[model samples]
Target: MQASEVDYLIIGAGSAGSVLAGRLSEDPGTQVTLIEAGPADRSVLIHCPAGLALMAKSRQLNWGFETVPQPGLNGRRGYQPRGKVLGGSSSINAMIYMRGHRADYDAWAAEGNAGWSYEEVLPYFKRSEHNERGADAFHGTGGPLNVMDLRSPNPFGPRFVEAAKEAGFAANPDFNGAEQEGVGLYQVTHKNGERCSAAKAYLTPNLGRPNLQVRTGALVTRIVLEGRRAVGVELLEGGQTVTLRARREVLLCAGAFQSPQLLMLSGIGPADELRRHGIAVRHELPGVGAHLHDHPDVVLVYDLPGATDLFGLSLAGAARVWRGIGEWRRQRSGMLTTNFAEAGGFIKSDAAEPIPDLQLHFVIGKLVDHGRKTVFGHGFSCHVCVLRPRSRGSLRLASADPRAAPLIDPAFLQDPDDLRRMVLGFKQMRDILNRPALARFGGRELPASASARSDAEIETFIRNHADTIYHPVGTCRMGTGALDVVDTTLRVRGIEGLRVVDASVMPSVVGGNTNAPVIMIAEKAADLIRAQA
Candidate 1:
């Protein structure tokens, strides 16, 4: 498998790449090599489900990308923490196993992607999951990724649901069920209390296969092209430039940002923009890094006095975390098993809206600045975001050098409609947070959002604090339009041997958390590729 050439030379051993490698290598005759720019996913911080909080400040396994100054956030740069590890963002994400609303995918099919409607893609989602709840019309069993309720959920999570109920939202047991509306505790990508990331689900188990080879710390610099067709790639590994030939195809699964960067770096992007970066354009695809969008979320923090169940930086909290660590080591069950965003829901910005256009994530902590800035108290936070934002953004190269981080401009809140929905979404979430069910534990609202009384005040607060909930997609969009980078089968429109099989290929960001959908994309992609082979 380590030979100079492989049948599938997959770049980026993240969510999609892991699935692609695992599925493609199921054929004993096929050779697959999965490359990751980061080190191995062997960190205790990575395996321990609760370690993500500490990962916020550590660059050890994160591509800590900061957006260019955004005009909408009063020119403040947004923080974008992408996983640089094996499972990609799924390894560092909140681990909520959410499949967006059905209509979201139906819309994709309607946009000319024939095989991407909800009913068409649902099987792939099921095929990739081993839901503890067992096989059903909407869920599957005996699959690589394990989906289950938290092993040791914080009691406050149920209270959050109750609070949402008091605010008039129904309690839904499964957000991925028939209806996406209503509050509930989220299912996580976990098995026996630990994370079941895409790597763990699809790649790690198959690493022993003679046909699958995984190389870590190998940063792919550029795709080696010949007459507009991808033949292989040139990468930097062990301080040496290495060229690996692809006998079949070169798959780009580097997620939204790097996927497009590698495409442009390889001389396939907007002609003029590539010229400015001194890259010779091999293809004039203007949509490589265009049509970028993500969920824009705002959080409200409130102190919860005398709450020992919540995570905090206090003395008592330290003692609890210490015990939780020991408990997790012995049984893989404890507070450590909890994904911080324990409870949430999909609700509408207004009744007139066709589907839920807003989503919520209630954390059993005061998640200040995505948990990078520590707040010293026992408290909880509730996040509400415009699920389908009108704002669009773009990612562009800052330099021709492959090592440089690209200029990311999410253009959050650039559309006035997104801002309007945020104001209304904020009011609805504030009402849920202030309901009687959540009042038993605590104190006043955090100063940042408490004083906002009028709609204008809420709008100001939203503009000041809102940023991505980490679902960025549509950079290498798939459609029949002129700007489409890939086609229905995810093949790059103008390239023969290159295809994007990550979140970047999503024509539109889905309605909820994106990890599950990304995995589904890779699952269906594996089938499409095999069908062709």
Candidate 2:
């Protein structure tokens, strides 16, 4: 395609981009082009549920970005594996379908972002989902995104829930149900036991439409701006610089880190920062990459000697998985259907908290260093994260080149209260894992957790191990404040024909998994853009 006129040219065919392209192209009059930096999402490791462990260590399907050394993390760099495929992180991530707490969106409205309250946005959430358990007032049927219960979860998941009950937490069947205050197995974003990523749900189904064009291996260099308005984009594809003009809009759906990086590279960020990088400034948006944050999580690993149900590295474990693969291929159910973080919950760090301050994920395998490191033997791990962290960080330009990674500083555990909450949440996890119900399944705690006894010891342990649970948001925050980057309409405040409709525009990070919320955001954004047309 030459320098063509695209009615809506969307950057990054990830979670939000896929939704926008699919929805905006519904009208035959509207021509949409969705560009993705990564290749196609055809790898079997992506579709298989249990393949997440191997995907985590391999950079084949991900950006494999890492942070600058974080002071709060005891001067250790944290791993950030963003999906470099059509589905974005949703393709490579654990397929847990979570929509976070309702109060998270309500809080966005409280901060002057209208149409973002829980009540206002619930319809979009409902519209984007087709839950396997059937739809009700809170859920909708016949949607693009497929939400379902895991095909065949390990038995250890139920045991963890039982342990939670024994530890005094209630057993809530659905975390995304009426109330999110108990422990249970998680429903996944899967269809027929295969991963149903955002791209698969929204993009792939609509690819045959004449108005929609999907391009892969397209790296957007910068937004093509004339004076103060973004009219198109310049992308490096096929070893050539290609310019595609957007007749109506240039929608940016890049995730948290790259969205801001693109804006900064396009000369729409802080003036001094752009000038120092030797990039010409077109518009100065101070909050382009500010307010970066994620759910800082700590994992507690245990060495269960008599484990038979958990995934491990031994010969017996490989044999079990090998047999399970055949079962999954035949019946679409077995151990291979595990999402690893199969069971999870939402709970308060303290009883005085208004809503759940901490979220729990009980993995059926030992996850050390985001599963990048090899922890031999059979065991289970529990992850605890602060739902709402007070700490904030930023993403800045690492180099003038567009291909270079950004300077990601999540500033984890910077706030004293965040550390305090994490310490408290750690105790909660240890209690649940050591409960009488799980005593038969429990063994000696891992070395790092075992050494941490007092509150101070726990804090030290957290500082040494806490990293992102992969839910990063609030970089190009949406609001009306001085530092706000986008408005409630999802449009960049100072730029015309440009809008941001990804997790980056979130005013704050939601309390649970971010994939579902991002799909919901794009679902509403499509309506907002079309309403004006």
Which is the leading candidate under lDDT? 1
- Per-residue lDDT of model 2, residues 238-353, tens digit only: 99998999989999998999999999999999898899899999999999999999999999998887586898888888889889989988887899878999998998888999
**CA deviation > 4 Å runs, candidate 2:** 1-3
Q: Model 2 — which ten-residue stretch has the worst lDDT?
A: 1-10
Best by TM-score: 1
TM-score of 1: 0.99
Question: lDDT of each structure?
Answer: 0.92, 0.91
How far out, in Å, is residue 477 in model 1? 0.1
Residue pairs of candidate 2 with colliding backbone atoms? none
Worst 10 residues of 1 by lDDT: 435-444
**Model 1, span 255-289: residue lDDT tens:** 89999999999999999999998899899999989
How many pairs of residues collide in model 1? 0
